[model samples]
Target: MFVLELGLIGLCVALLPLSYVWVKASDDKFRKLVWMTTFLTLDLVMFGGFTRLTDSGLGCPDWPGCYGTASPFVAHAQIAAAHAALPSGPVSMTKAWIEMIHRYFAMAIGVLIVAQTAIAWRARFKRLPLHVSPWWPTALLMLIGVQGAFGAWTVTMKLQPIIVTTHLLLGLALLGTLGWLAARLTPIPVYEPQISRYRFAAAVGLALLIVQIALGGWVSTNYAVLACTDFPTCNGQWIPPMDFAHGFHLWRALGMTADGDVITQDALVAIHWTHRTFAFAVIAYLVALALRLRGYESLRRPANSVLLVLAIQFATGLSNIVLQWPLPIAVAHNGGAAVLLLLVVMLNFRTASSRPGRAAVPTRDAAPA
Candidate 1:
């Protein structure tokens, strides 16, 4: 019963953007829907980060609903009992609201993706000039379903570090895919033969970014951000003592070793240090890639976006360490990563679509009236 209610809520939330695109777009409604969905997915990713950072992940302690209800309001008595039992623990009215709101937003995004898939198939059946294949949204719909499953697991698994980290990765993956889809729908004029040469480099940069984000997610999920508490060096040592064996153990519960023993400070330090150290390499490679892409006028926008977001990421990341991980800066850091990923995905699409002899083609589908 709660599941159906939740689905209805999601549908209601999704109608706003769907109606906007349907009415105001006037043309290229499909493209507008894709871009709008991409924007909302980015927001969902950042809110997911906030949910994790604020320890609200287990606030509801149930899947797809708060205490098996569609909204947190009805679960107030249960939440109050839990909070009364452990005032500082994971379950609280505020945290429950935060967690449920995040879930609601995610469900809404799921609804939007379904609408996109339906419209794409409709366009295909009518043999419209839809520039991109309908299968793209179909794939996005499938990916979002997997992401929803992981969202449930992140709760059912008790916020296990690996599960939470994987959830973050999958969310970002969905965001990146939507970005790619948006790029495909909106054509850019690219004539540079040299741009295609950077495709491999762009791919490598994106791969490295994914790895770095995974490590960062590991750090966040494990609550290891403040383990080092220093800049340029961890814990005032050029080389800090670390327990990589325990820190990198994938299947263990949160803050515990593989043997079910409580994790040590060294393990936390290990997680934080690895994320910090690898960040330098990721930043350097991406900066160089952005500089290379800047030489081409057609690629300049995304290239500049990369550079700008990279700078914000560096600043926010450093602030996370030196400023003791303020919430705003931390959330901004997470958002910066999402934005950077979007830019890089766009760069990859542009480079791949623009070849030596071919000019970038716009979507062929005429706007449906």
Candidate 2:
């Protein structure tokens, strides 16, 4: 397994120079291209969420190569057989398509990261720093390798809740990391002196948001979203019966208790209820942070965007439950979370890069060009 993983890394390394050549060969900004790739990666993460939400993780029922082919077009017979055996289960042509699409996007992002790393190294050898840390690319490469392993486990382990939720968190971490790299590549104008003070708060907010997102992922992956199905009250009461022990059981297989018996409604309810309550904490912190960021000129746009995305997330989240997890709204809710993640990432990067205290003080104004 490790050897195959290294072989994939070698492939990524071999593609790095091509990114450099392509960037140098084009009139487009490298940073902008990176950001574009990052955006697509974010979309891929959302689609991955959709895949898991729809129980399509096993749609293809295979590994890196879907059903022993590059796409479902070549594996139609196999998919049909699996689907026919279990009409509402995880195998189907549609599911295979979704799974393959997710892989394609992952490969593209991996290619981009490899390219970025190569360009940085080349630029470094030329006695001009790429102005960005090569370690960022290296870290991305390593993280993706781990993500691939988790992806494999997600299928092999039959979508265990903890593994799936960790996969989701890993995707968010990559999004934020790429967003930070993109921000570093292209400078943002800073206008405030007190921006440094917000850095600590922003850091804390990001941490809290990550935890909340993890809980949400756990709830969704465990099929716990509709456990309660009521607002301001769970099943018509504030404190509904909950077997947190079973619900929080981390090592159990999907739809099964720790003892291997089928899971109960109370367990799902415990999972769903915990996520709902955590939502309150996440929203409150993000809203407060957004309001604080409004005081900074450079951060106002991202702050407003954060607020808007949160509002959309709230609405979509409710719609998912009220509508019994309709596919569209559920997908949108997932996408909204990705957008919020990127927005916060950008804001944090802006705040860090603009810290007057850390930036080199201007000794003299550059002579008029």
Candidate 3:
């Protein structure tokens, strides 16, 4: 506890000086700082995926520290004991290092959010109306606290799949929130266009994709990626055996039956199969949306971003199965989910801001559609 407290305090102390220099740099420096923070948060999200993928989530077996130390150096003996006690268990020196690194990055992000909140509040009297409220960063700070609790539960609960999946989703949610806020801070003007009749459909599609992402997270957390192990087929058949009830038993232990026994093979298959089945729907919707948005110059970047992310997601998802769940591909698959979430959030933001006659389109005169 002392270690975690010290680390957090050090993070705050470090940020104050850096932020002072950044804010004093120029208006552009402020923008760059926000973007740098945002980018690092995105990287942090990816690193988080790496940690979870490697099953290092429980490395420290505690929150904000590894065996009561900020770094694994002092906790090395404790980690070795835990690892030797269970050779293939969750606690090892490597895993402890990964976990602590994640904590540090998370703390840094918290600092950035704090800095953003301060800047937003100060800018209110200094000509930046959008920065006046600071409500968004305030909300983010609260959400990060909740996320931290979930992180603790993730370890204490022994990596219960539901809690783990929720943690993953929350990270992506943070990414999306930051992305939207960053977009708002940019000089890009919002365009209120006469959206086509498919706006409702697009909204629906986006919502469904988000839901599908949750399902994917569930599948990953439960270690169900290899349950099926083949593309377009599960265990060499279109429909393999499944036990949805047992598979989705949310209250059960990680990879265990409701009775505290190890989970059955059928349950794993059930979880994996469900995600695979739903993915087709997600792909179709995204492809169609991408094709539709291709002709609209304003929507092109986001549209292409969606398509590119979808392709990367599909490839990485397949790679996870074909490569026997290699760490890189699995981590990439998780990162792709974050990327897609950000893209969808941006799409939502663009569509919302593009309401008819609400704001002028940015760069309208510079480029021809």
Clashing pairs in 1: 129-365
How do all models score by TM-score?
0.97, 0.89, 0.90
Top candidate, metric lDDT: 1
Ranking by TM-score: 1, 3, 2
Alpha-carbon runs more than 4 Å astray in model 2: 1-28, 360-369
Residue pairs of candidate 2 with colliding backbone atoms: none
* Cα lDDT tens digits for candidate 2, 18-123: 4544555443345655677687678888899888877789987767766677668878888898889999888988888888777766776777777666666665
Write down the lDDT of every candidate, Cα atoms only: 0.90, 0.77, 0.77
- Give the TM-score comparing model 2 with the true structure, all chains together: 0.89
Question: How do the residues 1-369 of candidate 1 rate in per-residue lDDT, one tens digit apiece?
Answer: 999999999888889988888898456888888899999999999999999889999999999899889988999899999999999999999899999889889988999888778777887898877777778888988998898899999999999999999989999999999999888777686567778999999999999999999999999999999999988999999789999999999999997899999999999999999999999999999999999899899899899999999999999999999999999999999999999999999999888877764555665556465
TM-score computed on alpha carbons, candidate 1: 0.97
* Model 1 per-residue lDDT at 181: 85
Question: In model 3, which regions exceed 4 Å deviation?
Answer: 1-30, 125-128, 189-192, 196-198, 360-369
Q: Which stretches of model 1 miss by more than 4 angstroms? A: 356-359, 367-369
Scored by Cα lDDT, where does model 2 land?
0.77
The collision pairs in model 3 are 191-354, 192-354, 192-355
